[model samples]
Target: MSQSKSLLANIGVQVVIAMIIGTAVGAFMGHSAAMFAPLGAIFINLIKMLVIPLVAVALISGAAGLGNSTNAGKVGFSTLAYFALTSALAVALALIMGEIFKPGVGIDVSSVEGMFSGEYASKGELPSFWATVTGMIPTNVFASLTNANILQILVFCLFFGLALSKQPKKNREPILQGVNTIVDAMVWMINCVMKIAPIGVFGLMAEAVGTFGFSALMVVFKLFLVFIAAILVFGFVIYPLLVQLFTKTSAKSFLVAMKKPQAVALSTASSMATLPVTMNTVENELGVRNATASFVLPLGATINMSGNAIYYGLVAVFFAQLFNIDLSMGAYVAIILTSTLGAVGQAGVPGPSFLVVAVLLAAGIPIEGLPLLFALDRIFDMIRTALNITGDAACAVIIDNIAIEASDLTESEVKQS
Candidate 1:
């Protein structure tokens, strides 16, 4: 309880300080005041650099262990289902909040002239849904590794791992055991790498607060509030309810287990950085089975971006409103669809939300509106990371209920404790 309170208080203080600093710079010094942006950028880059290798090695090791075709298929389906449900819910929440708040109604588009000049050429309509599916099968596993396309790499790893497992027991047992040993060592190394994350997070936060200042924050104040609210409600309330409804776990115990990791994720603002803590918490504290945590937490860290999905949808509409673009109902639907996918595609990067904002602008809305929001990105990113991890835990609990042999405590004990 003390730890939980401390974590919450720490996150609150950091957010408040960041907001005050951001508002002051944006309103006072203006956009040219980019003195601190590099600090945050460097911090974000370091975390991202670790993500590809972490995902590749971890997924390969985990999948390789689950050699049975049926079990592998079940894991794959469950993972995809969780991702789809969370992403869709995020989009829906954004749409609902956007309508209720109408955050962009009175904003002046011209005041921020020359804000964003469409500098980065659009990546074009994210290859259709089919493209995402087809592209998963890498032409060459080595090529996928070189390209660092996580989805393709995951595909290659899954098949490769299963093939090794399918080999005759006499031939495969020793190899599988040896691979597990290597995996254990690599995971330990990854955990060691994460010890420095707090420094990276502090630098990123300091730099972001330094550059953006507070003035730009006021520009999209309403939208920012709505986005944060949506993330909290969905990640904390809606997800817990679902977990309790489906799993024999109480939300309180699960949430208690998540407290430390949540703090790490919030401070670092990188789900990947928090994965080790998340995995440990779920397996040890929450008593989720190793198979469930290994499969769910890692994948959730990479692909199941509930908070980003919400942010993307809300920001797209908010940008449209700020620019006086006036999105039709159809456009809103398209935003829901594209933003969900965009969030996943950009997950491998450090600042994918900002990058995807460019994608949204090219799709039709005003890119200039992004500058105002970008100022608040770091602050929002922290909250979004917290929410992301929460979603990951919730998914783990649900899957554990479905797959784990037995849990340490009953749902009632989970609540009472």
Candidate 2:
């Protein structure tokens, strides 16, 4: 009981620290903000340095661990459905917020158009929707590794897992169990790495506060407000509804379980880095089965970025308005759809929403509007990561409830039958 209380206290501390840090960064002396910004960068880099190998190994082994083909499909479909629904909701919320606020109505359009740089070219690098779908299959495993290609890695894992599922039991069963053990061990190792989180979080906060003072925020205040509001709605309102509708479990219980991990996510500002805590919260606290938590949390960490989707959609609209580009209803729909895809596509990158903004601009929306946004991205990222963590926990609760209720109902019917 003491340990549980201590854990809860730590979570409260984390959230308070994140807010204090973000506010300080937004309001402090400019030179100080600049001096400390490197600390945050170093902290972000440490987690990112570990992401590629961690994701590749965890995902591949996650796939191979699915001993049965049927179980794999059930897990896969559930995970994807959650990602799709949450992402769509994120996009819708962003669009609605952007239109209502008109954040760019009085901004200097020249700041965007005049300062446009060639670096933005990479924004157009992604293929069309169909192209991304078709390209999911990895052509060269080593090449994908060298390039740190997440989609390719995801593709490889799925196929390899499917093959493992099909192998004769004598050949596959032991391998599946062994792979599962190894993957779990890898995740454990990552948790050991997370022991450094407080130091890293402090560094990240100090630097961010020292570098971006509050005066600079005036340019993007409306955008920041929109994002915060959307995150609140999704985190507090939408997630609860989904949990109640799908799981028949207590949403209150789910939120209670999520407290610690959500705090960690806010401080760290990286969902992937927060996975160990998230998994523990879902399985140990929320009472999700290990198999479901393991399968769902990691995948959600990587791809179910509701916060990123919201930012992408809103930023696209903000840039369009700043450029005096009137978006037709059709254009707005495309923005929502494309940004949803982009959120998943660009997951795990630093300032990924910037890339999404550039992508939208290439379609003629105005990429130049991003500089004003760049000033506030770090601040927004903190909130976005918190929302992302919340969404993942909500999905876990809903899925767990679904699986459990199904089991209970089946048992009851069987008893009667």
Candidate 3:
């Protein structure tokens, strides 16, 4: 009884069971399974309610704590570099896979003619670089907070935290202590919300399967298989290799430790929603310092979307192939660069992936067939989300080791002197 209870208590095991049952229900009940959607909505709403405050408090803690370290600048640079480079690598690999497999080669667009639409055409235009950059700055912090404008909130809190660190300890500790207290309260609420994760997973999976059904999937099943293959390569092969190369954490152990957060990411389909669980698992199970986990994971959840990179690259190639368009060398370069930047810009939220449109437009691919994918986006979103959080954890592991190595090198040099 005790052993069985433990298994049932494990969020990962419970989520897996819920997913299986939910898929079965959706397959059986078809559209009727959408009724279960309220469970997912309620759970997601509860998580969203906690997430804004959590991101606000946790990021402040991370920035302030790291600000006190001698290597704060190094950590910041390395974290951003890792996110950019890995995202580039992910998209490049996706392009290679798409080229080799050619999933869209024999696809018959005529059968799905009714589904195609040019309505999404206007959305394909990329926002100008200056506009995107300027948008990150906040005019009013309170208004940004109310609207859940994450980037602006991040900028303000990071600035506020770093500025706070420059103050005398007498002035800083009380506010820091109070913010830490709020973070603790937020974590407590996350734990409470997670207790119902199984129900949410069931509802979400049921609704996704029932709404999209398997018939539409036949048109894109090859794309699905290839996408999963690419995700597996990135998740298992690339991430594990990087961890073993840079950190003391064994590849197997890192993968094992990440199972809980990956499950949560899969069910919730939002990195922001999965942040608390990722922070907990990375710090406690994976033995990263709280400050490093706090710093890297949140930053990663916001910008490091390697999974989205892969999806965008593959979607561009899929559409190019579907139209029999012989993409130029310039088009490949455009696909890679646009996909990389687009992936980084993606908000850490659950929804249909619209970033693929920007990548397609960059390469001059048609946007009509995109509507076919919108229906299946939820399925793709769930799988890629699990991969996304895995990348976030991998960064925490590797960055923490970099800090450790830097400190040890400093100590050694001092002793030698």
Candidate 4:
């Protein structure tokens, strides 16, 4: 009885079980599997319901903790720079993998050519750099909170947290305590939502598999195969190597602790939805301090989309090959730059990403064939979202180590003096 209870208690085990059952149901139920979609939707909504408040209070607390320290600026810079560098690396890796694998070389697109559409053409237009910067700063934090404008919310929270930290101890202490209390409560609510995670995972899997069977993926089966390979290489190899090299946390421990959040990310396909689980794992299991986890993880979820970068880069190469277009050096440059930078601002949600359109267009690749992949986007999203959250944890781990080292150095210097 205790053993069974423990199995039931393990979120990873439960989610895996749920995914297997869901696949079976999807295979059996066919189109009727969509009935389970609301279960997944409700689960995602519940998580989203708590995300804004959690990010707000948590960032404030994290920033407040670091506000007086000189490491605050270093932490923020390192987080942003690390996200960009890793995303760029992800795109470069995808392009290399896509070129070597040539997943699109022998495909018969004429057969599914009817599925193509120009509907996504307009979405390819990315905002100007200045516009994107302006967009991040919220004029009204309340409105941004109401609308769930994540980028803006992230900016305000970080700024507010820093400002709050600068206040007098009497003023900051009670308020920081209150904010920290709210963060703890938010985590409690997140844990509550996770209790039903298995059911939600089952529903999401059932609907996705039922609606789009494994057969639909056969058209792009090679793409799927190569994409999975890229995910493994980056998630298993690159991120783990970085963790091992930079931090005291062993690669095995990092990967093992990440399994739960990774599974949640796979089932939900939303980094934002999985943020709570990521935080729980990074801090409690991985031993990252709250201040660092709070600051890095939230920002990473909001902006760090290395997973999307891989998807975008690989999809561009796939289509360019499918159409027999010889990409110029400039085209390759455009693809790498676009995928790397464009992924930075992507919303960490479950929807089919439109950023592929931008990458394709920037590289002068055809966009009409995009709809073919859209059908299987859910499967791809699940795979990549798991990678995305893993990258987030990885950044948290590395940055946490850097922060610790800097603190140690500062203390050592003071002692010497």
Candidate 5:
């Protein structure tokens, strides 16, 4: 009895309970559950408060501490290659699933009046691809931070950290220490916020269920199932195979080790929230080197978004189908490219799925379908976040293995010399 009671005290367990309670309350109370909206907002706000600082500090510190020029370049190039390849694969899988399932084929939008709230209807056209890429370079660093432009912040940090890496060790130590201190403080802050996560999740879920109700969910149910199926395939089948091929880690062990972090990710619906656990598990449990884990996972959290890539591709196709928009071959190519890049820059939080708006605009699909997507965002957020962090850990393992092989080769060469 005592053991069972203690187990129930765990935050992950509590969060699951909270989700159930929130869903029940929303179902029964309906729109009145929107009263809990503020609570959810406060929780999301707390997590958001930590995002910019945490991402900036983690990236700068990781890059600066990444060792010699050759190693840093190697790791950087390798990580980017892995991210791009996986993202492309993810988008391809989504497109395949979307075509096969045809989630929106039979839906009649004519009778579905006012299903969307028009919250995300675009006021202006989306920027061109070149324009979007150029916009990643921030004109005003402080303004970018204030606006929480993730790609802009990432671009600035990459340059800043590269510069810092070129400085003498004695000159860089103080700055690196300061940045590490900030990272520690941010992680500590996240831990503090996590104490209230159950309540926050409860409120968020309640608000979503209450305001949108089951009807909104039903409208997108087919797309939701298709999305979930894609995630399961990626997480269970694809990730495990990659891990085994790259690192010799068994799928069962990796999955078991990830259970805690995955649960937290599912509950909080934030990859950033799961970072600390991912780092710990990858290093201590999974045997990934600290250096590799530190550099790869933080960057992965910001940019390596397989789950987002899949979601974006499917959502774009779904909207296109619903509106009977016949996409040109050029549009399909654009969706693949834009969705992959968009996932690379997406924030690792609940609502960053909104980035799909940019993809929809680029594909010439109307943004009027956004509200329907938004209504079911939370449900999908949970699953995708779990996949995002899982991919991060897998990347860490693969990189760590490569680093070790390189070290061994260097050692053998030195001995032979």
Candidate 6:
């Protein structure tokens, strides 16, 4: 009885309860629920406030601590490989699940037609592939930070951090220490923001439900169901199995340890907000090495987003169905590739799924449907962010184990010599 009471007191539980209440109230009150919008907006803004500085500091600190260029290169290569492979698998799973479920089938397109506007329609044009690549390198660092351009910020941080890492310890120690202090302070801010999550979640839910109404929700209800199903299967089954296979880690223990961070991701719907918790859980509870956790988790927070990739694939198909656009096998392949690449490019950006606009354009889906899709983003964002951070933790564990095995082999060779 005592344990159950404690469990109910957890913030995650409170957020869930709040969501239910908000949904009920929104349904009952209708448009009047818009009054709650300010609360949710404030909460989201608070989370956004931390993104720029937090990402910059975390990336800089992680890269600067790499000891030397060789170790940094090896860790970088491993991290990118893990991220790409997992993201591709996630996109594949989404495409398969989407085909099986056909989430967008039977939706009355006329109901959502009014929701589409000229603003969103014009915003869907994607830059050419080469332009997208070059765009990541910022012309001005301050401009990137001010504009919250994540890819550009990531590029600048990589260069700056690598340079700092190469400097003498006596010269760089103070700078690294300063960056660490900033990270700690940003984490403190996240915790403080989290205390209000139940309220924030309630307001956000009420606004979405009230504004869209149950009828609007039902229009895309199947898509929502498919997304939830995918998240559950990926989070519970696939992730744990991978951990067990790669690192011989106990799946049950890993998931249990991950619960808190997962909850934070779900509530905030920001992987960046969940980074500190993910790092702490990986290092302290999961016993992943600090070196591996530090380098991998921060980079993962920025670049590893299997969940976003999955979302891209699923939603692209959903929109394709809604618009009666038939995608060939070749188009599906393009979606998987584009989504995987977009996930990497858009990492650390809040509303990471917004990057899916590019995927839709590439796949020849009408951009007008984007507004309707955005309506349901908040709910899906929560789950996808949870999956993302979980993948990050799993990658950390796998990489850490490989590093350990390699070190042991090297020591044995030395003894033989």
Each model's lDDT: 0.69, 0.71, 0.90, 0.92, 0.81, 0.81
What is the C-alpha RMSD, rounded to one decimal, of candidate 2?
Answer: 3.7
TM-score of model 5 (CA atoms): 0.86
Give per-residue CA lDDT, model 1, range 195-309, as digits (tens).
Answer: 5444444445555555666666787889878887898789778988887788878877776667677777776677876776687788788888666676677778778788888
Top lDDT hit: 4
Q: What's the best-to-worst order under lDDT?
A: 4, 3, 5, 6, 2, 1
lDDT of 6 by residue, 69-154 (tens): 33456667777898999899999999999989998888888878988765655555556789988988999999999988877888
CA shift of 398, model 5, Å:
1.9
**Worst window of 10 by summed lDDT in candidate 2:** 64-73
Better TM-score candidate (1, 5): 5
Name the Cα RMSD for model 5.
3.1
lDDT of 5 by residue, 1-417 (tens): 999999888777787788889989999999999999888788778878887787788778777766543467778888889989998899889988998999888988976657655567553245667887898899999999999887888888878887898889899989888988887788788878878888997997788778878886688889999999999999888988898888878888988788777876876688876787687688889998655776788788878888888998999889889989888888888888888877765677666366787778778888876777776677788888999999999888888788777778878888999
Candidate 2, residue 392: how far the Cα is off, in Å: 2.4
Q: Against the true structure, candidate 5 has what lDDT?
A: 0.81
* Clashing pairs for predicted structure model 4, backbone only: none
Q: What lDDT score goes with residue 239 in model 5?
A: 89
lDDT of 5 at 333: 84
Task: Tell me the lDDT of model 6 at 314.
Answer: 91
In candidate 2, position 364 carries an lDDT of 64
Q: Where does candidate 3 clash, by residue pair? A: none
The superposed Cα distance between candidate 5 and the true structure at residue 140, in angstroms, equals 3.8
Candidate 4 residue runs with Cα over 4 Å from true position: 1-5
